[model samples]
Target chain A: MDNNIIRFTYNVDGTDFTSAGQASVMLKKNLRQLGISPDTIRRASIAMYEGEINMVIHADGGVAEIEVSEECITIMLKDSGPGIKDINQAMQEGFSTAPDDVRSLGFGAGMGLPNMKRYSDHMEIESELGVGTTITMKINI
Target chain B: MKITTVKELLEAKVVWGEELIGKHVYSACGSDMMSDVLAYVKDQSVLLTGLVNSQVIRTAEMMDMVCIVFVRSKVPNQEMIELAKESGIVLLATDKRLYDACGILYSNGLCGNGVRRG
Candidate 1:
């Protein structure tokens, strides 16, 4: 029995901007029910939420996998869309290629990657020009 | 400050969560950008924004905020109200635009991360 770990998976719908953060909200509820520390839950959810939004804005939607453990929580966001051309620049604050429409929604200030980096204890981005992008972030519980 | 105080100060309409108005909130962040709210915010228990969408409520939920104030006469639709209801977050709408609403709260001592990060 894997007493140390629990996992959850979600399919993010890309078409609707309004539905973008639903996965993160669900994850927050799951964390609360698991009795995770509030700080840890906040950090994990913040990181995951930013990734989920980025997936919608850039990749048209994706899949998020969440794993909770005694030590830490890990979230992986994978998208098969026009991959990030420059991970370095994308990680920079205030640099974004998200369409203006996304900006109107109060996102696309180029803070997604930076926010994820700031909240997560560890962050990784794997992106290819036209293939896809996968971001993995971990926050210690 | 109690959530009811926020309502009085902003002269805001109670869109949802009337039952939560009596709850107390220590700090607040005002931002239209949801990610900014998520990033620059820490320990703030209230969210003030002009954005009307489901993510607004979700952002509040992720940050563990107790209340959300929509500025500039912006009101969330039915779906957003349902989301807030599920999260037990108090919702208010003010004809007071973002700057005025946030400023009034700020002068009244309801604040953010102490560094004005948001």
Candidate 2:
């Protein structure tokens, strides 16, 4: 726990798709108040947003924690649901297991993890078959 | 181009942010899939979509987009409108379809060539 690091924790609710992105929206506001760069804020916000949506769609919700430091911003998402069977396949663009209804809502397009990785400087995913999944992503400030 | 110009080009009805129409935008992208929008879009100030959801507003907010145009006359619900209002993102609805709305805006100088960054 560095003195300069600020942490935020949020509980993402999987029951409601309409409220899926609330965490990301809050993070964006908090980052702006901290006077972080807009690009950095956008990157962090977008990456976390995709993660938030994933948790709701696939993981039945999760806990998201964001830590801000002088070096970079780190996002940690943990979800308890059907874990991804193949991380590599899940990482591939256009490879989604989301139901058809999710697609109608403008998500579940198989771009979540890829988008998270694309926006962040670094990302790592850890998942177990029936246990859960944890994703860690970092964005350089 | 100005938001006013976008409104005119697409003949869009401002669902919200009428006062903000004076704002200017440089680039725009049209996508119903928020995934692709998050994946490839950069510095895109406007989003045109047929998808109606609060996530759409959240996606635009995440991208720092200032305006959203709902093509095919799709009306956003109250919750979505509130979210957009909170984010200060303008909302516009048009009777034109997605392709037609995008074509009009592109032909009117609102290019999709967003400034890319690595």
Candidate 3:
């Protein structure tokens, strides 16, 4: 395996709804500049964007770490917010705990986790109710 | 369809990314829900949406969309415009509602290839 890897890290700001997807936008740009395939880049960006938005809306903020190897790109999003009580329920489409205000902004549609899973080649979630949640996703390049 | 044609069809005002006006896009999806857009859209270059928040632009960016149409006279804030400009995604606002705007474009050759099929 080629080991020419690149890494990126972004601190998601949970305080502002307007800035929710900024990290994903930046990652997309960097991937494009690196000449990644559009399909792979799109998949990774969508998955990462949903995760980033979830961090803001649910977890109050988080840290995103990205590692790009020749064969795949991996994202690790970890947040210190109240952990998910029911991971299975949260993964279901059309199920959301978001308030009406989030709906008003045209999100909280309960499609984030599903879309994240749909777009990534591999996904893993680890959470503790009182602790935090860490979601790992990978898209093979 | 060429983006210029999309602009003409919607009678929209280009808010930014004038240089991208001549680019072409094949399909479009109109939705206010960014989450749904992210989930359903596949290979769409144009997004027609009513939402005016910054995430609208970010959603487009995540999908690698080249253009966004804000239907129903919705206007984006400065932050949204800047984000679009940075991504080189053309932004347009049309007085036509989402349905009408989509209808015009669909009839003119931009079909619903990117939208989720029932």
Candidate number achieving the greatest TM-score relative to the actual structure: 2
Candidate 2 lDDT over B25-66, as tens digits, reads 999999999887887666799999999999899999999999
Candidate lDDT scores, in order, read 0.88, 0.92, 0.90
lDDT per residue for candidate 1 within A1-141, as digits (tens), equals: 477789999999999888888898889889999998898888888888999999998899999998888888999999999998888888888999989988888899999899999889898999898899999998997
For candidate 3, the C-alpha RMSD (Å) to the true structure equals 1.9
* All candidates in order of DockQ, best leading: 2, 1, 3
Model 3: pairs clashing at backbone N, Cα or C within 3 Å: none
lDDT, candidate 3, A86-127, per-residue tens: 999999999999989999998898998999998888999999
Superposition error at B5 for model 3 (Å): 1.4
Of candidate 2 chain A, the 10-residue stretch with the lowest lDDT total is A108-117
Docking quality tier of candidate 1?
medium
Worst lDDT window (10 residues) for model 3 chain B?
B109-118
Q: Tens digit of lDDT per residue, candidate 3, span B4-26?
A: 89998899999887788999898
Compose the digit string of candidate 2's lDDT tens values, residues A11-123. 99999998999999999999999999998999999999999999999988999999999999999999988899999999998999999999999998888888899888999
RMSD of each: 1.9, 1.2, 1.9
